[model samples]
Target chain A: MNKKRIAIDMDDVMTDAIGRFIELYQQEFQEDLSDLRLPGRNLTNTVPPERLEAIKQYPHQPNFFKDLEPIAGSLEVVEQLHQRYEIFITTAALEFEHSFTPKYNWLKKHLPFITWKNIVFCGDKSIIRADYLLDDLDRNLKTFTGTGLLFTAPHNAHVTGYTRLNNWQEVAAYFLH
Target chain B: MNKKRIAIDMDDVMTDAIGRFIELYQQEFQEDLSDLRLPGRNLTNTVPPERLEAIKQYPHQPNFFKDLEPIAGSLEVVEQLHQRYEIFITTAALEFEHSFTPKYNWLKKHLPFITWKNIVFCGDKSIIRADYLLDDLDRNLKTFTGTGLLFTAPHNAHVTGYTRLNNWQEVAAYFLH
Candidate 1:
């Protein structure tokens, strides 16, 4: 039987990217950035409008995209969902040249069941065709024609529209049921 | 500049699948199959009709898709072309699950630069949006809205409508020029 494809984004969705960024900022300034807030409160939106370039440079960091920890229960839920549907890790990476292998290696290590063929490294998510997309950024989901689930993130907490998923277990229950 | 993507088929375009199939058929019946002509011939249209079921079993055989040798000069030309265009290995593999990893490993070994993200193992080519597609069958290219170059194969040799490429040299010259 042909299975419906569920495309999942990497940053802030599967990977605990916000946690890492907050931790990184805390280490640099020696201050608590966990309470840091954004003006628009979108994960994709940078604070003060000046740190956008700096935020883009994080992927270029040695292990920024590589060493990110997966959200709690994400790996287990992914494995469970993999048995029932075709799960694709559809991520946008055209902006980062050095992020290719690091992200590839991270998926290989963390989500070994997802074959390299199922992983898509794309620039624009608009060209991608899938049944559902789990992402934190509204930009990708806004343009996506499929069912876009706004996976919960720090900044996206204030944003609305489309279904919201607080965690991986919720995603599993939604798709599996 | 966003370069045009050139999607190439895996079976006959990259690997010598036609040569292997003809050789396998010749060895099985201990007779000449090379003299067999094709205009209405397809990858599934095995002569005598009795071999049709057996032809479908080829993908299940271990190393069937893995062990095929690369076409002469295909690799070198691909290397040269990789510098000029965004090359993707667009292959149809839903009919054969065992073929996925083998094809992936083959490309990794043979064409390391073409990352897993660029390689697409798809069933239907209709949704694929590439600037150009180099394929062995008319069914794939016929649905493609982009320019299609039918790479020469025993099954597709007699078919017409799209542009035909006899070898990798022609492909490089067409795209590189």
Candidate 2:
């Protein structure tokens, strides 16, 4: 039998891209643009489009990916789960073609254990089919027909009525056991 | 001049109480008690009151806190900021005495570097005062008069118009820099 497939969200589920964007935006603009949303609601909108577009064009920030801290125990969990499941990253940053490349590179660099073939970047996650989907967004989770594990993100704490895992350790334990 | 004080939330901010409770309840009851809140409201009502009451009395799950993973970079950032500011944990789990003790003990044991005197456990955060408050709830943020750094929680992603930080590294850089 084929191993079950698991799709994971990127922004908050794996990397701290949203966190870094806000830091850089605040430094350059002297304004906190954390509340703004991207064209789609899946990703964090910490910088305005005009500024974000510009920032994207600039050479990737120094140690941009290396600085990104994975959600606690994410690396270990992914490593363990890889033994039983085919892991793929389904993110919503499709519009920014090259924007997520650095992030992908960072993920590859940091989580050398995860194969590059498993990474899938797209704006709409509903298109993907998997046995399990781990995401922080209710919309994404609702769209997925699989066993959805809602990663308890700070923003989504208000959301109720779902299987919520606050840390990667719980997620790992949930799947492994 | 007194340095600006930092107010941090406890339940999801520092401790994985919600996650722990769910995991333990599921193991004991053999039922998936995932959602904690009611369908439409932020209040926890998904788990029936009778079940919640019973679940609450179960022996404190020591491994729950022991196995918890901190929010990415939260400890390092908190420690770094402790050098310049009065890092105060102004959490709101004090209404239930039973719940508060374990959460407090978990944080105290995991993060011993934080001063015991600086920790403030209360039922409502609106009653507290601070220079800057890092919280995951929009309601709590709205109540505070100071600059509220809405921690970019997964659910709160839908809510807009606030300074948000997705992880502790960005938070530390935001305040320290």
Candidate 3:
């Protein structure tokens, strides 16, 4: 039997993208984000209106995606999942043209087991064909043909109705078990 | 009504990849390829076995894919098809790691209408979701779930199972008419 394919989103699903954005915000404004409240369904909404424009520009910076810390337990869980299913690290990299090389290199450095052949850099997730998609964005999930397993993230906290995986451990239990 | 999506291959379908390789081979080896016999199925088989390794390394060189001339009439035909169908310029770029930027840049420069969102840089075409896939490689077509429209090239001249389109004009007639 053919292995079931799972299309994995890179940003908030695998990498802690909002966490990186928060770090970039703190460094740029010289302010701690700990005091701020986490806004539901949109991380940028938590920041001051004036700073939102600047924070959005972070992805355009060189190496912005290069050093992103993977979500807690993602590496180990994804590594195990790789053996059981076809995992494609699909990301919406077109919006930030500069992120292409850095994101590709980051995957090469971090997930050395996932070969270049399985890494996909595209904009729309609707074109992806897989048995399942683990993504944080509800919009992406809404468009996908496969079963959408909403990976829990602050920006996607408001999303409901789809199966949610709070963390990589949950992801493991959902699939591996 | 939703427009039918067409996942188009980039190398031989949109760009003249083999033609560019032949040009590079002539320039590097200081030998004209005009006298060489055209092999039925594989373009590389036409070249001397001793030069195949060096010829394969051409894509690894910077800007090898950037300056490739688009296949004859592809620009006009695809542009017309774009208005009718959801066209995605999908290329197998993972094999050529350095090609990510160049291929993206090439599309921006040439097919500016096909935005970055519609462009996909992937390895296996089997993961693509579309109503129709127009590709030059028989292998890519064989794996695609949708209707595979074989785009004719010297390398695929011998392949005969699927519908063959000889040129861009033929592609236009097939889709538009």
Against the true structure, candidate 2 has what lDDT?
A: 0.65
Clashes of each: 0, 14, 0
Q: Rank the models by lDDT, top first.
A: 3, 1, 2
lDDT by residue for model 1 over B135-176, one digit each (tens)? 988888887878999998767767889999988889888988
| Candidate 3 Cα misplacement greater than 4 A, ranges | A34-43, B34-43
Error of 3 at A110 (Å): 2.1
For candidate 1, write residues A1-177 as lDDT tens digits: 688878888887878777777777667656555554443353245444665566546666766776788888888898898999878887765345455556677888999888765776655565456788899888888867789999887677777888999888899789888
Q: Residues A1-177, candidate 3, lDDT per residue (tens digit)?
A: 999999998987788777777687788878876533353735456778877787778888876787888888998998999999999989898878888887888898889998877888888889999999999889889999989999887777788889999889999999999
In candidate 1, how many clashes are counted? 0
Q: lDDT per prediction?
A: 0.74, 0.65, 0.84
lDDT of 1 at A114: 80
Q: Highest DockQ: which candidate?
A: 3
Model 1 / residue A130 / CA error / Å:
6.5
Error of 3 at A67 (Å): 2.0
Q: Score the docking of each candidate (DockQ).
A: 0.10, 0.01, 0.84
lDDT tens per residue, model 2, B37-97: 2223222345676676667554343344454556667777888888898777765532342
Model 1 spans with C-alpha error above 4 angstroms: A1-149, A153-177, B36-46
